[model samples]
Target: MTHEPSGLKIIDRFSISLVRCEKRPTSPFGCKVGLRSVIIHSVLLCSSFKKSRKYSDVGKLNKINFDSLKRPDYVRTLTIRCRHLSRKESNPAAGVFRDFRNLDRLEIDRCHLKSLPSALFSGLQNLYSLVVKNAKLSVIPLDLFAYTPNMMTLDLAGNELRIEPYALRSLRNLIHLDLSNNSIDFVTNTLISLTKLKVLTMDNNRLTNIDFRRLPKTLTDLSLRNNFITTIHYVSGSVRNLRRIDLSGNRLDFIAGSGSINMLPPSLRQIDLSNNQIAFIEDKSLAELKMLAVLNLKDNQLTELKVESLSGPENRLRLLLGRNPFKCHCGIRWLIHSTEKTYPVVLDLSELNCSSLLNDNQKLSLTVADQRNLLICQYDILCPTSCICCDKPVCSCRSSCPPKCRCYRSANMESAQKTRNVVMCEKMRFDGSEEIPDTITELQINSVQLEQWDIKKLQKLRALETIRISNTSITDDQANSLYSSRVLMELQLSSTNITKVPSNIGNLSQLILIDNPLTQLTNGDISVSEIFPQSLKLEKNQL
Candidate 1:
């Protein structure tokens, strides 16, 4: 055994030897002479020494003299961190690692390297894994790995390299390759050489297209997220072993069913198509994926998704349908009726919103139970320009004052019975050609312009019980027929052009005639009101 030099410490514990070559200013070139070489020969010669060496915070002068190492074949694993190597060597990386013939695993991190010499890895045929991450490498020479044909795993992520054809021809046994976070816009011919690749990740790149026919048939997991790809083309029998595929964050607008545009492999277990422009998925598009478990379709433009589209052999599928602008219609009945026995498990139902008949906008879960009556299959009955017609239970109706004058169902009113449906109109201009459904028991109108014929139509609502109109103009003749409703209990006529109160004003329980042009309230009006015993609101008037 050689004597230990200054700044070089040796620790032996439990058949494991650690040689640390730390900095010493007095030593030549800021490092102990023969520090790493001597440690390798002395410590590695032992029968119990581990074959792994880790160099931390390696400085410029603590250069690893690979040529001086006596037993390079004994070394198996080498990891270097924060070691900024100079680019001036004729064969920069080859000169550093050429002697480690028996090296199996090597990892270089945070080196800030911009380029690699053509003969960077010229003599490491036994290498199994190599990682060069967080560097500024722009290009990988086609023959860079010609000497390392047995390498199985190569991760060159976080670089600026644009892969070229035959760049990885030597890696025939590669199993996992990660080229994520790079500037490669096109890789049409770069991966055909890796025949045994199982997992490949090319995330956060500029790839615009992916031809699945060119992918290795042995692949099981492939992720191409955050790319510019508009469509994926997959020929039959290609990528048959693929189990998980992530094609999220793209511009895919539609997914056609089998025998159509894109045909997916049947062995897939997970498919992620979130955050795209997908508006439609053809019926049974993904039904063939019998083994699929997780289908993520969140953050898209889907208006309706059918349950049959997600059919599989088992009930293990979880459908992700959040952040989509789904319309409230019978087309979405599949989602509304999704159950454990009927369809796949749905996630984020509360995060989905839709425009429905009764409510313009509401959470999808709120309308699921009442979807049968709320979601109309088609718009057979057209409403006026500013009106919306919704189906409600035949419950008694309540009227709200402007500017929110929408009608709603109320069964707790003092003088009401749940008899017929109601249609509340706001800012409506009736043309008399339109027929209000005869099933309404209450009619509330705000900012409505009603004609003479329109009044005749309302006068015949046999179930009419409440009449509330505001911000309108009415004549004495119109008032006569309006206040003459036999079943009317409450009447409100505010902000109107009426000059006189109806002769039968006292017939109602509640009267709101404010904001009118009445100049005089005749004695008959007050005396009739006092005798009939009603609630009156006559504010904002001239009387």
Candidate 2:
């Protein structure tokens, strides 16, 4: 017997067992043994598994015939490569890989195949894994995997496949399936037949929404990152075994939840909702997510987070709350207290910042154990006289002649929709120095004296919507600027001295101008002809 450095070259008098080449073989290699029993028991894998080979320009072989090799059934693993050729010349004949009956693993790279026959993987009853990547395969036949029922892993990533439903129904025992980097748009009931599937990945697709109830119940890890998904729906007990779900880089505007009915599955342990457009989270949204351990809400549009919004299981949830425009108020002190306690620790606590309107619109850095007392509620400093303001739904002064304003316990404006605070100052006058709270939505000022009304302060109210300024003279400039508010919907200027309507009414749904001393609606270029409101009340105004 003699050995060479290039590869193993066995030369015996009775038989020739195998001839394996190292890298870039210049000639054909073969294996032949004297006895059939020796061929079945000895020569196992006689080819390079993952090596690159460049074909010579002389022979220019386009395909391989495993039948010509001695003891082809003894080969346990095989890797075929088609390099340096046009896409049209790289396709191999159908059933060319059927001779290796005992193959355990097979990989075909850069084959540029457009489709596969129904019986392409026939007779490979012992195959455990198969990988066909970087090919042009678009449509897979329904019965493609009928003969490979024992296959455990199937990876067809980097292909052009838009899989049809029941395309892989024959592989009941498939454990992991990676269909990433494809053009699949919808996957409704596409993978429900894989009863034993554990992990599934469909990243970088064109998926816009997903229903988890149609997925296989045995799946544990699911990743649908980098898609156009806007909403996800999953009922309880639908995906009972799912643990981790990654939905990063999507267009989700809010986490799906209501009072008690939410879209969270009970068995989820970790959820990644980072880099989305989530601006609101419903109260008790996470109450049913008892097994959750990690929650990521970074780089979103959240203005504030309520304590009830984060109330769910007793588990210490690890949070990621960085890069959000949080409003620095007393409502966010719960999060600061949680961070100070070090239970349910924020992973990116140092990267958090909040903007304060009372502090001259400055950005406040949020460090651990800092800014605990700096947060204040809207009514704590700007409450009106003879009116009690508390962070509850009902105030004690509501039984008086004038209705008292209610303060929302939550921080943000959208938190308490049903119980918004409405400040009422009837039959009173302000000294043009007292400021209204920014948290109030509706302001009712009746019979008040105001010759120096601040127009800038009215525009700075982020949540102000309805204004009822009665029995006060409204200057033309102030009236024009007030009508130009982007957020105001209803403006009641009843009994106020006004002559002309502002040209820039700006999408107001309702406009009231009753009992005003006006003869003709004209102010320079201001024309009331173009004004169109859904409901306009001009009963007592002079025309």
Candidate 3:
């Protein structure tokens, strides 16, 4: 009496409250109860009902028990919430959705319905969203939705659905379909015909293979999680145009991008292949994913990952590579000291765990950046050592590291690989006539120890670009070789007793002379008089 004075009905025994009244006919089959929403609290929904059923009358309202019944023919929205009734409970009836004419949204969750009559929903002409889940229905009865052609979203998860070909051919407007946590295995033309479909979720199914070539190109998001998918076959030049796809919890060992072509469409932005059996990805195939921005490869087998390989100018990808057994060795040095400009670097670098060869359970992790330095790290090579006659895999300290020297990448190299680099041979660690690595592109030293560093050895690094020397003294012979050096664009000298400029040093872009007493310009030491080349910036010195 307090709620709706005329058309509204609020039943306390059955816990049904109708919201927002819309005036319509009050007939048995007419949709004119004036209620916009129907909330059924405790109602025994049966498979069938007799005609003109009006068992419970609120006009005779007092304390009512179960078995309250109504025609419910005009209900526009209906929900049956029985979490304890998800299995088949037989009830002799003709059909469930017999006279629901104006129903737009219907949910039958947590109900045990063994089968549905073909014409169960033959009366719903305006239904848009249908969710029939947590039911033990193994098969979708033929033509069950033939009358409800206006359904937009079909969520039938937690059901034993053996999806057959053309199972959803009647749903032309359905865009989002969630059949996750079902027993449906392989996919057929059962779904490809829905050209308008954009998102499909079939996670936790028994699927083995999904023919990528036949998949709908119009689909933007597809999820096939927790399946037995090992190989994904697609054709060349005909890759699916998806924005995101999740294939997590599969049995994939390698990602070779299918036959004859390594192509992932440019439309794809994120891919999740986590918790799979993936050992490695083909490098050539990865580069084909040109537009990927986020990649998840967690809980897989990956040892040496060149971070630059997964990203480039076209794709600056963030990677999730946690829970993989990583070797703490030189193979991953490129990831540590790489100079290449890989964009959107991995944010989860801290989770990169290490498994050493000596003791797999030794609880080792990636050495901190400082400990990664070869000069400071290789001394102990705490990892198991191997001398494999040079044909060994990368990350073997004995195979890659020189006896003792800290190596760093060259500034010009723009990859996450340490292929082109320089070495720092501190004066204290220098012994006379040490063979400087031919790979060193720029050399730096604190003292002019020509006998130990061998200034003439600089000619070996044809790629050398810069040199910094805090010299104790520069001999005449050293100055002659230094001035004629043609590979240098920058040169720096810092010495308290020294002062000089190379005659032919105009070819240098920048010449930094730091803290030197240069009162005189003669005595084989030339000082700047007026000006020099355009690219030179002469710093503090005793003029």
Candidate 4:
């Protein structure tokens, strides 16, 4: 055979005799260059050919591809590009790729191959990965991966089409499957047989629902971003090994069965439900994800957050609720008062914009704006010699501490701080014999003898807002109680006398000064804030 000056050979040069009426498959390009020229091009592309040249079309990302090609090369990995295999030009001879058994990966990119030979991948036994991106492929045959049993990854992105049932049943060893950016409208058993699958990315598709109970339990990460998904039905029996799940940018209004289901697999660590239409989440929903460390709810439809929702034991959890329409009302007092420590809660309060408070036009930083928003106080509690102010917007001679600490509208006392209703206590002797009742809001004992305060059940006052004991050294339990509440807005105490302030402080109450005489200051020691009560009648012997 003779080669042309351009390095391409003509079919006529090979003297390949053709019968007058031989049956031949038509190529979409119109003309058949003959099997001889195709073989010559194959030799040119072979890596073992010492004189073979490497031809690459660099700027050809802009170039359109034609279909129906003969074999191009015999390499360890085959990359078939720029071919438009329409139904009329679908050549069965393309099955020649099956001869490349040593091939480990296959790429059919940027082509219009609407149909492929069923046996196209039949001989690629060692193939490890298969990629068919932007190929305009509309359907995947059931046995497409029949011969590639060792395949571990299948990336079929940008192929908006349908998949035959059991399409991937043969890929038993597959661990990663990506079907993103497709137009698939439904999903069936196409993935039910992948018992070993680990990572599945089905983003940018048209999927509207997902029944996790039908998926493989071996999955560790599953991403379904940017879809039309409105529901994700899951049971505890599914995804027992899954750790990370992402369902962002969907159309879900709320998490189905998120609450009351002790059914989420404990293996869960991260959940991303961001950029959706979610408006509310129940506390049990938060509790269902028991071991979760990260929860992202950014850019959603949430307006209010109940403090009780985060009363779970996951202290290390980092909740992301930014970009949502959060109304800064008394309903969110649990976060403002920092009572999270009571139930052990911490949130990623960064970038959380408040929509209802202050300037609605300008977004408020949740972390920075929280302090100013929570300056509300509502009690004029009469304290002891070492008094505490539980909740008094304008503290004075009038004592108004909550009698029993009841603000929560819900039966859950865990969120008592969220409600505006409050009660402050009056001065009472901490007579050890009284066995301080659990209902008291503030307990002020002016007992002088150290032995006088030990008889009271200080720890039993679960609802107690403040404890004022003077001239007595702090005990570990009492110190813990005080450390836990010494800084409480109602139990206001000077840091000069208090020890290390714990990092986990929930709510802080401000001293509300109502109609009363100004605090009489004495030396720096008697700062206006140090006075037990502005209305306390000064005895002649004391002054």
Candidate 5:
């Protein structure tokens, strides 16, 4: 009985049938010559396999013979670090790795593999790629990618997956599908029918909501960063070949006023929404994103901002607005006038200061001429009756005036100005019932057309200091007859048509000119310091 067709005698009869089945062989032609030399070395290694070996062979025995089957044609790739197999020791009937049909690539890092046994890779059908990183698998077998139909890439990143719902219904020719740092909350509908999926990393997981409308419509790239999103409505009408979306550290405060990334599809560019809490962003929410560029909105709470909120200047946006709370006022003066004409290099605006107007002062950059000189000093210090007389009493008005006024009291300098202290009626205007005479201190009747002062008129001015009738057409009974003057100090009237502003002017307390532009500063002709009031100052003659 002679037989020897050296492929080294078919590796010495497959190493003596694994050393006679590890010495458990009870003779009988030693188990029929080790099953006929493993069916003639698996038919000479499946006729020298490789039509890229289609998932590597699980069906080619052709009446097994060759003195007892024993095939294994030089395995391709199969790493397994941190391995912990067990389920009765990875049973293929406990023959672990019984036959690795030309395995393509199968790494199993940090494995503890909880469950997986449905012909685990049924003799490897040319598996393209399959990494199970940090596996702690909770549940995955639903025919796990049904014997690798040429899997492109499938890394189950940091797993604990409970994902089931056609758990990847046989990976439809998967492209790249990393289940990133998993603890996956939900993603059903057969994992969005992997329609030849492009790249879909489920970042950080625990997702609050994401309905990419039944995904896999050739998704471009998506990451759902640090989950638990408050509201995003997943780009509305189905991902239309989405480009890129991260959604940084979610809990989004706003973004679903009816989705509208200009109705996406234009191959969306990129979006993050950094550290979400987004205070406001309406203006057509990214107005027709004509292929959006990039937006972050770092550390939100944004006081005010508008560039159509994000898609103005015909869509070539680039904004960040670093660490918000920004209230330099007048709605951030149109982002400092559109960051000096369109995205001034993605507008960082030097870490955008102003957290609730200048506190201890200093951070103020914003220029379009400082937002039009702060809306023209908040409209000439708040309009109403622009006034500012000075002849002593720079601000907290310090009394001292003139008396007895019938008008011409010259008495040849009446004994060198006998007790009329000092008065400087700077921006003057007076008429009828003229009893302001206590030898008037400092009265600035700016813009006055004093129709007919009533409400007991300045109650016979005792020792008035500074009084400004800013842009006046006065009446609140003439500002409660100059706030019932009890040694009147400083007073101002901003932009007139006074609707309300007399609460006794906080009882003057040596009042510091209360900014008065009379409100409704500016919105259209685009000026009034862009709409000022970081705390009011206005003096260029009230612009």
Candidate 6:
């Protein structure tokens, strides 16, 4: 017999019998057995031998299988990211662990992962960091991070994670956890279990409330901006190690509760609460913040502001109060007056102004000096005789004629004068007559009992520069004809019975007066330069 390359051989009956006899002691057949029994036994032995040989050949082929050849070696880091994977295709990360076993860090960004697989990080026992950013993941598996005991950082930014209780129960060793740009509405106990967490960013979420007591003690930075939080409470000095807190764009009206400000660690240097509904702030709420440097309160519903609220012994604060409705009245008059001198570098005085105190009769272009004088001298007339005695000489008075020469008598006489030009008249009344004085450059008819004015015939006064008809019963058309003088520089019709002003008033090339009772003024073809002359001056009676 000869061996073939395919390991097949054809042997004669004599040769088979000789081999069977040689191994008969170990076989079940004996030498006394006939040739028929020997041949059958020999054939059975050969068949068993062939089957064993076939199994040996298959064992060699199994050593070089295609699966083992494709398996990658253990590496220090592994990253699998598929950005263009559509929803119809299978998730590429499903079988990514077939090769990566000793991976220390894995980062997956912008992938089409609908849901996380169970034990995704099981084989990565040494994984120190895992990041999944911008993935369309709606849910996180319970045991996603069970095997990664040494995970130091876990980032799941830009996902739709519904943060519930015990959502992150196994990541106890996490140092940094970022769940920003998600739709997380609540923060539960599982998030608090990250005792080793140093930094956490949960910005731009839909969180309306938060239990500050469950915050980690080691947290240094926390961001909760762009949420529907109307108030921030339930924090009882638990976050002792917090350094920075960002609560901008929340709906906070004010900071309430005892120890709420004290809960902030001394290391806290910045707090942003811009674009909120804060109307008022107590002085004591910010007195404890010694280390606070930057405070933003930009857009709020503040009608009045007191700088003393933020003043302290060692004040290191930079405040922002722009875009707030600051009423420029007695409450904020001092601030408007001293803004240039006292807070030259502190407040943004350019953006601060009176919103509601000024009447429609008042000009919007009123300067700080103008506001100061207007506020000091109210609409009430101060009579010098009220503080004078007959025995003492009237130094401020020009002359004394008779008992009827008193200020009230003179004012009453002035009120009865129907002529448009009455310098001596304390109040002038118009009855629709054309008799207007030509020397009238300044007229004061404020709060008088005047009912009618024939302004169309009063055009004869070419020298009329200012006309004050505020707090009167003049109609809109009457006011328009009164201010149509080509030489009129200032006109005041505030708090009058008029509701609108003629657009042709802008055509008065030298007109500058705009103290009207109307809510809006439409601009005409005339430019502002032509309307307001260089000699424009608004008087108290005009406003």
Best by TM-score: 1
Candidate 2 clashing pairs, residues 3+ apart or interchain: none
Candidate 5 residue-wise lDDT, 227-271, digit = tens: 886754445457777888887888777653244322334457777
- Assess every candidate by TM-score: 0.66, 0.64, 0.57, 0.56, 0.30, 0.55
User: Higher-TM-score candidate among 1 and 4?
Assistant: 1
Write down the lDDT that model 5 would get.
0.53
In candidate 2 the C-alpha lDDT for residue 316 amounts to 79
RMSD (Å) of each candidate, 1 decimal: 9.5, 11.8, 16.7, 16.7, 21.7, 20.6
Ranking by lDDT: 2, 1, 3, 4, 6, 5
Residue 463, candidate 6: Cα error in Å is 23
Clash count, predicted structure 2? 0
Q: For candidate 6, write residues 29-82 as lDDT tens digits.
A: 101111111221133433332332222222123212212322223234434344
lDDT of 4 by residue, 357-388 (tens): 32267555555445444322333333333334
lDDT of 1 by residue, 482-503 (tens): 6765666778788888888665
Q: Poorest 10 consecutive residues of model 6 by lDDT?
A: 26-35
Q: Give Cα distance to truth, residue 161, candidate 4, Å.
A: 1.9
Q: Number of the top candidate by lDDT?
A: 2
Alpha-carbon lDDT of model 3: 0.60
Model 3 lDDT tens row, 1-543: 333233345577567665443322222211112234554542322211221134333222211111222435546676554436323353313344555666878776665676676777776878998887887768886687788888888889988877742557888888888999898887776676677778889999998887765666678898999988887766654335688989999988776633543245556788898999877666545566667788888898886565545653265567788887776545565554546556446556778766543236654556452153321112222222244534445543232224455555422233344333445555554553235544455566665344543555665667777777675565545654665677777776777355455555644677776777755466333333234545444456776
lDDT computed for candidate 2: 0.67
Candidate 2 off by > 4 Å? 1-21, 24-62, 65-68, 81-86, 259-262, 339-343, 358-361, 368-374, 380-449, 452-543
Residue range 303-325, candidate 2, lDDT tens digits = 88877776775777788989988
